[model samples]
Target chain A: MGELALRKPSGTLVALVAHTLRLQLKSALIWGGVLGAYAAAMVASYLSFGDPQQMEQIMAAYPPELLEAFGITDMSTIEGYLAGQVFNLAPLALAFFPILALSAAIAGSEERGTIDVLLGNPVPRWQLVVGSFVATAVSLLLIVFIMGAMMYGTAVLADTELGFVASVEGVLNLWPISLFFGGLALLCSAVFHRRALAIAVPGLVLLAMYLADTLGRVSEDLEVYRDFSVFYYYAPEGSAITDGIDWASFFGITGLAILFALFAVLVFRRRDIYT
Target chain B: MCAVIYTEDLTKTYGKARGIRDVNLTVEEGEVFGFLGPNGAGKTTAIRVLMNFLRPTSGRAEVFGRDTVKHSVEIRSAVGNLPGEFALEDKMTGERLLKFFARLRGVKDLGYARELAGRLGADLTRPMRRLSRGNKQKIGLIQAMFHRPPLLILDEPTGGLDPLVQEEFLRIIGEVRGEGRTVFFSSHVLSEVERVCDRVGIIREGELVDVEPTDNLVNKSFRHVRLVFEKPVDPGPFRALNGVENLCAEGPELRFTLYDDLDRMVKLAAQHRLVNMEYERPSLEEIFLTYYGASEEEDRDG
Candidate 1:
């Protein structure tokens, strides 16, 4: 666990990304900047909702399905629109970064033959995997937490009456969803040992899940496909956009993560380190 | 003597390609075993398998009495490995990379890594990506030796270094061997192996053809001798010379494999016009080629 701590999930994640990002402090600033901009944009959209005439006009422009697809089902009021902006559009940015982050831990290491150098030590492969996963998970959790905090602040500033707890809940709802995507990406990295494949994996996963969700909502015959996408469990359909904390769903996603991570480790161990 | 590194008909395949096949090898404890082969002879593959980077297709490999595949963690804990090719991260400073590997190997300080790197003339400040091939090899060597593992597996470890650095690498090996650790290192270059290795294994394609002490293998093999005379004469009389293998005759020149004592041959040659006489050492490269047998995949079935 000492070496495991060194390869801790957050550290592993940071290690992966720092190198690819040239280990410059700029990438961190850049991610922070993006979240800040998203927060600002959500606040601007909510401000437009302060005008009843403009709010009604904006709501009529996009259909409920389109808004829901974007996780923006309500622009009827300021707080609702902020919820739409954070849970829907924001998770995409957070979900995929961690995959890139985690895959960098192994895919990049294996690619460069650095895995040989690192594994030449006494540390077990399981520790390396766990450390990498933990690093990725932590980085992702941090990114989502910052985004959630910013969005919650934006929701309150737009409508001063909005409850901080409700706003925070809406923001936090996206963590497990991001984890599920991160797990999916980890599974892909285990299967395909190349960085290109690892980089493209998260996108393909999200696309497949989106298609599954579309199929789930469209026709009666295709409803079974909804079970395939973890997004189905995270769909924002509550009154406060993310009413109470869904511990069961969050834990369910965590369970999925453990399963995916275990599968990835087992698969990784059985095969050769692909050059 | 106990075998520090041993293999019993070890086999490894990638898809349909032969990685290593039916390779029976043994490295005595504290002996420096040089794995000799041409490029793609599975030198790297075999080492990778022994290091647990790859699983064997069949058969077994053991390091210090531990199964390479099953007890990989234990094997790794006790082995230092240097791969043939590795791209260092451009972002990490050389100091950082060395420290990371040293720490991973359970070293509290980078003292040993820095010592080896300094002896090898590596620049710790520069990013590894910026280093020259020779310098990168220095880093690879440093990382593997930092832990002082009982068994060191190096694959093509000294390709880009100059003679001076090559000498330094040899010195490191000597120091390691003096401590009673076994070194299993590979090189396509024969002279290097001839100079340092106590025991050497010749691998061609994916097969292990021969394994013997350096002096014994060299003494047992034939040298191609070429002699010149003032006039043409039948050289067939010398064909039955003791220890000779391949024999050939040409006008005014006699060429044959010389396995017999060179002193007798020099006396025999002193009788001739002796326009010119020279013997060329049979290269280990040529000896390695004997095992390639065309393509790697084709020889597996045979």
Candidate 2:
């Protein structure tokens, strides 16, 4: 018989997190590479435009509501341009990385008939929920880091006026909001056994929140409704690039992610795990 | 021997769906216990309850003297389980999967895993998606046995294995028993249970009908008896004998199901100048059908 290690509570959690992270590394890199390349391309496009002032003039003619709707705070600078072109819209697509990953953690594992074999070991149910969330949270940061590198690297090569710190703030701010959606997916994943519902619930929420917050910015009548949308708290008016990351919203969105994950832990702990 | 597993009135139900009900069972240490039932007979449900995968609707269960629900992790630490239906990660090779599980289990060595893989002919190098059903089953079995856990809870363990692999698996079960470890496996395959199980629990329609020594369950059940007289004899005397049932007479041959009173039947046959005699013990499958035949019909009808 092989020698067995004494089962420690912390050790099990670490092992689970490490295992889940390892499985998620490839997907994270692929997501990061794709989105990073897009961000880098946006930086290149900004540089290719002959003069920043002329580009700002053209953007100014587009109307303030249209600019606000697109989350363009200032188009005269690369920070503003990349914020509008990449980071603002990036969460809409990039958030799905963690959303898809976290949703698969529980409900997806059940659908695939893989949960039984995994939970058959000494893993606690809460560990499955928390470990997946922690790993995915880390994976989300990796994606953000990769996007940051690509965006900043392109800015440096093109001699754009974008600051390294501003670029860092722009990409770093994407983490919490993306993770907030991932948290919802994890909650859904825990509450339901079907993976489709887990993904769809969060997907629909992401679309609705984006539209509510975007339209709220364009119309006074819809302004109150923006408070209900998570996007309301995610980089309002592209402030993360100009004013640096809003510490309040950063932690708030992160807090919400932890809240949803906590709820997931509670719900998953009480329910019977199928398959 | 102390009880390794004990459950009292353990029941689990899925809304209107039937699950196990009032299942009280005790499995002693170092014994191979077989849970026998056909499909949808709550065998999997019962096993799930024991594993704490499904909570009981009423009553409770225990393993290693600890509550199944509260001490599940500790119980699982000492147990090796193979679920009735499971899928390994498609991207993971069998070796990688085992290593991951070993890490989770805090086991540092893969030597036993490798040995079991070799013995079972499990190809650990290939990804799970590339393996056939039988090959997947071999991996499943290896994972359950590799850690050398004290209690092995295997559900429908040999479902997809070929005969040769099944034989090797039974041999492994024998070795597990030799090591004084307990095995609790559920299967609808009667011959497999008969070959390895010391005690067999028969469940029907979401309830345990009987639990007895395998030998007793097989031996005490009815057998088929045939007698050939010198010439055509009246079947009345044979039918009148105690415990004789379903008597049939054709020419000089007499055949019937004998449930009891073998001595009296033999004496009666001797009086008729029995030219030949054949007595055969029924298989466990036949015995299961015979014992539960009425309830099975009632289930089908209602």
Question: Best candidate, DockQ-wise?
Answer: 2
Give the clashing residue pairs of candidate 2, or none.
none
Q: Best-fitting candidate, measured by lDDT?
A: 2
What's model 1's lDDT at B227?
87
Q: DockQ of every model listed?
A: 0.31, 0.38
Q: What are the runs in model 1 whose C-alpha is more than 4 Å off?
A: A1-29, A48-53, A61-65, A105-108, A149-167, A194-202, A214-227, A239-244, B221-261, B264-282, B289-302
The C-alpha local distance difference test score for the whole of candidate 2 amounts to: 0.89
Candidate 2: where are CA atoms >4 Å away?
A: A1-10, B221-286, B296-302
The TM-score of predicted model 1 comes to 0.83
Give per-residue lDDT, candidate 1, residue A14. Answer: 37
By summed lDDT, the worst window of 10 consecutive residues in model 1 chain A runs over A1-10
lDDT of each: 0.73, 0.89
Per-residue C-alpha lDDT of model 1 across residues B179-251, encoded as one tens digit per residue:
9888999997777787778988878868897888988766765678988888876665666566656667788
